[model samples]
Each structure stands twice: as C-alpha cells, then as structure tokens.
Target: MKVAVMGAGAVGCYFAGMLARVGHQVALVGRPQHVEAFNTRGLRLETKAFDETIAVKASTDAAIAADAELVLFCVKSPDTETAGAQLAPHLAPDTLVLSLQNGTDNAERLRTVMAQPVAAAVVYVATEMAGPGHVKHHGRGELVIEPAAGSRDAADALVAAGVPTEISDNVRGELWLKLILNCAYNALSAIAQLPYGKLVEGPGIPEVIAQLVTECKAVAAAEGVTLADDVDSAVRKIVQTMPGQFSSTAQDLARGKPSEIDHLNGFIVARAQAHGLSAPANLTVHALVKLIESKAQ
Candidate 1:
C-alpha cells in the first residue's frame, strides 16, 4: 500500500518507518530537516529488537500524499485542522485517513476540511524522535481504531507491518480512556521533565495522578462516555510498561514546542465547568502547563 504520514513527528515517523520496512511505499510530510535526512539516509528506526535505516520518500509538501492509499493523520491536536486542509487537495477519493493523535476530536476536526473517510484511533505506543529522521521506540505499538469504510484493510496492513490493531465499536470511550491517562501523567511529566517511573516516585505524585484521573472520569461521565472498568489498572501499567518513557507533553516542552495540554487536562476542566462540576486537579495542572508555555512564547 502507498501510505502518507502527515506531520511526520515521532509517532508518524515510527509508523511510516515500519510500513517502509515491510516494502510498502511510504512518504513522509514533515519539516525540512527531517525531510532532508530522510532523503539522504532514510529513517533511523531504533527499537528494542533492532535498529535499522529504512528507505522512504520525504517532502515538505502535502502534495506528497497525492497518490497515497492510506494517510496517517498524525499532527498534534492543535494543528489538526490546518494540516488537514494542507493535505485535503492531495488525497485520493478512496484514501483512508486514520487519525493517530492524542485528542478525542481530531478526526472530527479534520473532517471539516476534507471529504475523505476518517477514522479515530487510540494509539498505545511509546516513541520519541531521538534526532532528525530518527525515531526511538520504547514499548507497546498497538492501535484500537473506529471502523470506517476502508478501516479493515488499513488495520490488516498495519497488523502485517508489526503494529497490532483492533477495530472497535466504542472508540469514544476508548478515546476518553486515553485522554484520562494523558491527564493523569502528561502534565506531571512535563513539569518535572521526568520519565514515567521517576515521576511516580515523587512524593505525593500518586495522589495527584489519582485526583486527575477522578476529575477526568467525572467529566467523561458527564459527557456520557462509559470508559473501561480497568482504567486504573491501565494507568498503573504505563509506568510498568514504559518506565523510561517521558510523556509526549514532556517531549514537547523540552523542545519548546506547544503541547496538547489544552486538549488533555484543559479539556476536562472545560467540560467540568459545562456540567457544573469542579475539576481542581485538572485545572491546577492545566494552568501550570499553560504558564510554562506562556513563558516559552
């Protein structure tokens, strides 16, 4: 399959590299430096199993997706609409656009700008851009995606490329669960610049994570989302599974780039207000991260 990865950051590059490794035609649309690196020496994929450079095409232009059969919409939450618009004119009619993002509504946001079939995916992966055109994987690469027109085929391709995938009917709840996890850890990791295990080792951090998860659950309940019964276990598993992994928000802050805190914890705070509920934990962390971001401006 011919695939295009929009906003080819760490997550995008990982998937693009995996597909390319399996002999698929993969093209990446990203910044100039990574594009140059990709064209020069391919993508350096560092994983626990092995490290290899996989050859793939790269370009700064969204038109790189012109012939793509599958389009991985991997831009950050804030760039969803703009990036969608950039790629809108280039997509084929039958292209399956899977949103591999943090927020719950990125696929919906993308739909406003494009007429292609869009699916929302809950991505469970720990990866980071170690450097230009390089993606380092920490652990767990699986996707739970909502069904779309070509979603099954896409899932088959992803599974064949070593990415475990499942098609679920309740992606809204899945998205909420992922959001709750992000709220529980992303800000704490960002503020402390610590990995998951080390962040949890801090005094009072576990209590704070519990409070954030509770607040997020309340907001999600108010929104009529019925999350999994074992969300707490899932929260605990992050530290065990990806002990050395920093939250994506942490990576963003270290790079002095904007984070999706507004859509993670901030979204909970906003929804709590709409439902006449209080989310002080989420509010506090959201404010703190926003303050840090403000200084970065």
Candidate 2:
C-alpha cells in the first residue's frame, strides 16, 4: 500500500516506519526538520524490540497525499480543519483517510472538509519523537478503528505491517472511554507539571480524578455512548501502569507547545453544559490549563 502520514510526528513516524519496513511505499508530511532528517538518513525507529532506521519518503507539503492510497491523518485536534483543507484538493477519491489522532471528533471534522472516506481510530500506543525523524516507542502498538468502506483491508494491511489493528462497530464508545481517561489526567498533570505517579500522590488528587471521571461518564451517557463499567478503574490504573510517564499535555507544556486541554477536559465541560449538567472538576482543571497557556503566551 502507498501510505501517506499527514502530521508525521511521533505517532505518525512510528507507524510510517513500520509500514515502510514492510516494503510499503510510505510518505511522511511533517515539519521541515523531520523531512530533511528522513531524507538525509532513514527514520530512526527506536523500539523496545530493536533500533533500526527505516527508509521512507518525507516532505513538508500536504500535496504528497495525492499519491497515497491510504492517508493517516495525524494532526492535532485544533489543526484538524486547516490540515484537512490543505489535503482536500490533493487526495484521491478512493483514498482511505484514517484519523490517527488524540481527540474523538477529528475524523468527523476531517469529513466536513474532505470528501474522501474518513474513519476514526482509537490508538493505543506509547511513542515520542526522540529527535527529528526519530521515533522512540515505549510499548503497545494496537489500533481499534471504526468499520468503514475499505477499513477491513486497511486493518489487515496494518496488522500485517506489525501494528495490530481491529475494526470495531462501537468505536464511538471506545473513543469516549479514552476521552474519559484523558479528562481524568491530562489537564491536572499539565497544571502540576508532574508525571502520573507523582500527580496521583498529591492530596485529594485521586478524589478529583474520580470526580472528573464521573462527570465525563455523565456526559458520555447523556450523549448516548455507553462507556465501560470498568472505566473508573481504568483511569486509576494509569498511575500504576505508567508511573514515570508524564501526560502528553505535560510534555506539551514543558516544551512550550499548546496543550490539547481544549479538546480533552474542555470538550467534556462543553458537552456537560449542552446537556444541562455541571462538570466542576473538569471545568476547573480546564480553566487552570487555559490560564497556564495564557501566561506562557
């Protein structure tokens, strides 16, 4: 398959490198530095299994998507519309655009801007850009994508490339499950600039997380998405499972990049308001992160 990764950051690079290693034609559209680095030396994929450089085509222009049969739309939530528009005129009609992003609504947002088939995937991977064109994988690389036209083929192809992929009919519920987890940890971690373990050790922080999870669950229920019964336990388990890991929002704040708090906790707050419910915990943390972002600016 000829695959194009739209936002070729950490997640994009990891999957793109995997596909390229399997002999698929992969093109990465990302920052200039990443493009230059990949073109100079193949993308460095540092994983627990191995550290290898995988050859791939890299470019900054979104136009490269034109040649792709499958496009991995991996831009951040806020950039969804703009990035989709940039790729809209270039994508082939039969292109399968999978939104490999953090937020829940990115694929729907992309559909609004492009006529190509769009599908949402719940990504379960821990990766980061160690440097330009270098992706370091911590663990877990599996994807649960919504069933769509050609999605089965896409899933089969990805699984064959070493990324376990599944097509799920309940992808919306899966997305909300992940959203609830993010609402519980992301903003709080960002505001404290702490890793999960340290953040959970703070006074009354666990209670706050519980409340946030409860609020998100209420919103999800009101929106008619049935979240898992073990959702609360899942949120609490993150500290134990990935104790040293900082939330992505924390990493973004530390790097002076805009965090995705708006789409995480902020989305919950908005949905709560629409449903005539109050999400006090989520609202408070969302405001704090917004304030921190404002001060940083």
Candidate 3:
C-alpha cells in the first residue's frame, strides 16, 4: 500500500520507515531539514536488533498525500485542525486516515475539517528522533486502532510490515488510560526536566501522581469511559518501564517547541469542568506548563 505520513515526527518516521523497509511506497511529509536529510541520505532506523538506513520518499508539502492509500495523521494534538485542513484537499476519496498521536480527541478534531474516514489509534512505542531523518526505537511498537471503514485491511498491512496492530472497539477507554498515564507524568517531567525515575524519587511526587490519576479517572468516569481496573498500576509502571526517558512534553519544552499538554491534562481539566467536577491536580500542572510556555515567549 502507498502510505503518507503527515507529520514525520518520531512516530511518523518510525512507522513510515517500517513500511518502507517492507517495500511499500512511503512518503514522509515533514520539516525541510528532515525531508532534505531523508531525500539525500535515507532514513536511519536504529533499534536494538539492527540499525540500518531505509530509503523513502520525503517532502515538505502536504500535497504529497494526494495519492496515498493510507495517511497517518501524526501531528501534535494542537495541530489537528490545521493539519487536517492542509491534508484535506490532497487526500483521495478512499484514503484512510489514522490518528497516531498522543491525545484522545485528535481523530475527532481531525474529522471536523476533513471528509475522509478517520480512526483513533493508540500508539505504544518508545521512539525519538536521534537526528534529522534518524529515528531510534527504544522499546515496544504496538498499535490499537479504532474500527473504521478499512481498518481491518490497514491493520493487516501494518502487521505484514512488522507493526503489531489491533482493531479495538474500546479505543476511547484505551485513550483514556493513556491520558491518565500522561497526566501522571508528562507535566511533572516537563516542570522538573527530569526522567520518570528521578521524578518519582522526589518527596511527595508519587502522591501528586496519585492525585492526578484519581482526578483523571473521575473525569474519565464522568465521560462514561470504562478504564481498566489496573489503570493505576499501568500509570505507576511507567517509571519502571521508561525510567530514563523524559516525557514528550519535557522534550518539547527543552527544544522550545509547543507541546500537546493542552490535550493531555488540560483536556482533563476541561472535561471535569463540563461534568461539574474539578480536576485541580490536572489543572495545576496544565497551568504550570502553559505558564512556562508563555514565559518562554
């Protein structure tokens, strides 16, 4: 299948490289630097098993998505509407758009500006851009995508290309679970510029994480999302699983780039308000991140 990755960030580059490695026609739409690097030297894919360069088409134009059978909408949550608008005119009638992003509502937000079929997907991968056109995989690479018009075929193609993908009916719940995990760590990591291991080591930090999870769970429950019983455990396990990794929000802040914190904890705060509930914990961190962002300007 012909695939177009719309953002070409860490997630986009990783998945695009995977499919391209398997001989699928793949094009990555991203910033000029990364696109230039990819066009000239191929994408360097680094993983534990092997490190190799995979040649794929790269462009800075959203118009590159014009003939793609599958389009991975991998922009940050804040860019959902803008990117969707840019991609809308370029997409073919039968194209399938998958939201492989951080937050829960990206797919819903993307749907507002486009006519193509959209599906929400949960990504469980640890990847980073080691450099321009270079993606380093740290760990797992499984996906759980919501059912859509051609999701089954998309999942099959993804699986055949070495990406483990599942079509899930409970993607909302899955998204909420992921949100809870982010709420527990991303802001704290950003504020302190610390990895999960060190962040949790601080006094009262674990309690603060627990408070955030409690508030997020209340909001998720209000939204009628049935999160797993082990959601708390899942949130706590991040420190053990990704001890050395700073949250994406931390990475964004350090690089002077905007983050998806609004869609993570801020989304919890908004939904809590909507349901006549309060997520003070989430609101506090969300406000802090926003303050830092404002001060950086």
Candidate 4:
C-alpha cells in the first residue's frame, strides 16, 4: 500500500519505517532537515529489536500525500489545524486518514477542515527522534484505532508490518485513558525535570498524582467517556514499568522545545471548567509548566 506520514516526527518516522521495511511505498513529510537526511541516508530506526536504516521517500511538502492511499496524520496538537489545512488540498478522495496524535479531538478537528474520512488511533509507542532522520524506539509499538470504512484493511496492513493493531468501537475511551496517564505524569515530570522513579519519590508526590487522576477521571466522566476501573493503578504502574524513563514533556523541556502540557493537563482544566468543575492539581502543574516554558523562551 502507498502510505504517507504527515509530520514525520518520532511517531511518524517509526511507523513509516515499519511500513517501508515491509516493502510498502512510504513517503515522509517533515522538516527539511529530516527530509534531507532520509533522502540521503534513509530513516534510521533504533528499535528494541533492531537498529537499521530503512529506505523510504521523503519530502517537506504536504502535497506528497496526494497519491497516498493511507495517510497518518501525526502532527502535535498545536499544529493540528494548520497541518490539516495544508493536507486538505492534496488528499485523495479514497485516502484513509488516521490521526496518530496525542490528545483527543484531533480527528474531529481535522474533519472540520477537510472532507476526507478521519479516524483516531490511540498510539502506545514510546519513541523519540535521536537525530535528524533517526528514530529511537524505547518500547511498545501498538495502535488501537477507531473502526471506520477502511480501518479493517488498515489494521491488517499494520499488523502484518509487525505493529500490533486493533479496531475498537470505543476509541474515545482509549484516548481518554491515555490522556489520564498524561495528566498524571507529563506535567509533573516537566516541572521537576525528573524521570518516573525520582519523580515519584518526592514528598507528597503520590497525593498530587492521585488528585490529578481524580480530576481527570471526573472530567472524562462528565464528557461521557468510560475509562477503565483500574485507571489509577495503571497510572501508578508507570513508575515501576519505566523507572528511568522521562515523560515526553520532560524531554521536550530539556531540549528547550515546547512541551504539550497545554493539551494534557490544560485540556483537563478546560473541560472541567466547561462542566462547572475545577481541576486544581492539573491547573497547578499546567501553570508551572507554562512558566518554565516561558522562562526557557
């Protein structure tokens, strides 16, 4: 299948490399640095299983998606509308656009700008761009996507390429689950500049995380999303599962790049406010992260 990865960041490059490894024609649309590197040296994928460069097409223009049958929209939350607009003029009528993004509502936002069918996927991959054209995968490469017209075939294709894929009727719930996890950790990690282990060791940190999780769950419930009963346990298990791993927000702050706190904790705060509630814990962390980002700038 011909595939196009819009916004070839870590997640985009990793999945594109996987498809390319399976001999799928893949084009990565990204920054000029990554595009140039991939065009010259191929995409370097450092996975838990192997480390190698995979040959793929690379371009900085969204027009590269014109001929693709499957398009993975992987832009960050802030770039969702802008990137969607850029791809709107070029999308094929039959193209399957899946939003492989962080926060929820991205697919809905895309549909507002484009006539293309858009599906949302809960991506459970831990990956980062080590360098230009190099994606380092820490662990877990699986996707839980919403069922749509072409989703079954897309899931099969992804599974055949070694990525575990599932079609779920409640993808919104899955997205909220991931969002709750992000709210529980991302901002705290960013504000402290600490990994899961050390971050959990601070005094009163557990209580703070509990408060965040409670507020996020209330917001999710108010929004009519059914989260898992063990969501709190899941949030706490991250410290044990990846003790040394820093949240993506932490990595972004350390790199002097903008973090996604606005969509994580800030999103909870916004939704809670709309529902006539407040999320003090999420609000505090979100504000602190914004302060740190402002200072960094």
Per-candidate TM vs. native? 0.99, 0.95, 0.96, 0.96
Ranking by TM-score: 1, 3, 4, 2
For model 3, the run of ten residues with the poorest summed lDDT: 228-237
Expressed as tens digits, the lDDT of each residue in 1-297 for candidate 3 is 999999998988888888888899998999999999999999999988889999888898999887899998899888889999999999887799999998888898888999999999988777889899899988778899999998999899999989999998999888888889988999999999998889999999999999999999898888899884378779767777788778889989998888899999999999999999988999999999999988778
Residue pairs with colliding backbones in model 4 are none
- CA RMSD of each candidate after superposition: 0.7, 1.4, 1.3, 1.4
User: Per-residue CA lDDT of candidate 2, range 178-218, in tens?
Assistant: 89888888888888988888999999998999899989989
Tell me the lDDT of model 1 at 292. 91
Better of 1 and 2 by lDDT: 1
Runs in model 3 with CA error above 4 Å?
none
Candidate models: Cα lDDT each:
0.93, 0.88, 0.90, 0.89
Task: In angstroms, give how far residue 192 of model 1 lies from its true place.
Answer: 0.5
For candidate 4, lDDT tens digit of each residue in 86-156?
99889777688999988988999998988888999998777889999999987778899898878998899
After superposing all C-alphas onto the true structure, candidate 2 shows an RMSD in angstroms of: 1.4
Best by lDDT: 1
- Superposition TM-score, candidate 3 onto the true structure: 0.96
Kindly give the stretch of ten consecutive residues in candidate 1 with the minimal lDDT sum.
221-230
Question: 15 in model 3: Cα distance from truth in Å?
Answer: 1.1
Candidate 2, which segments miss by more than 4 Å at Cα? none
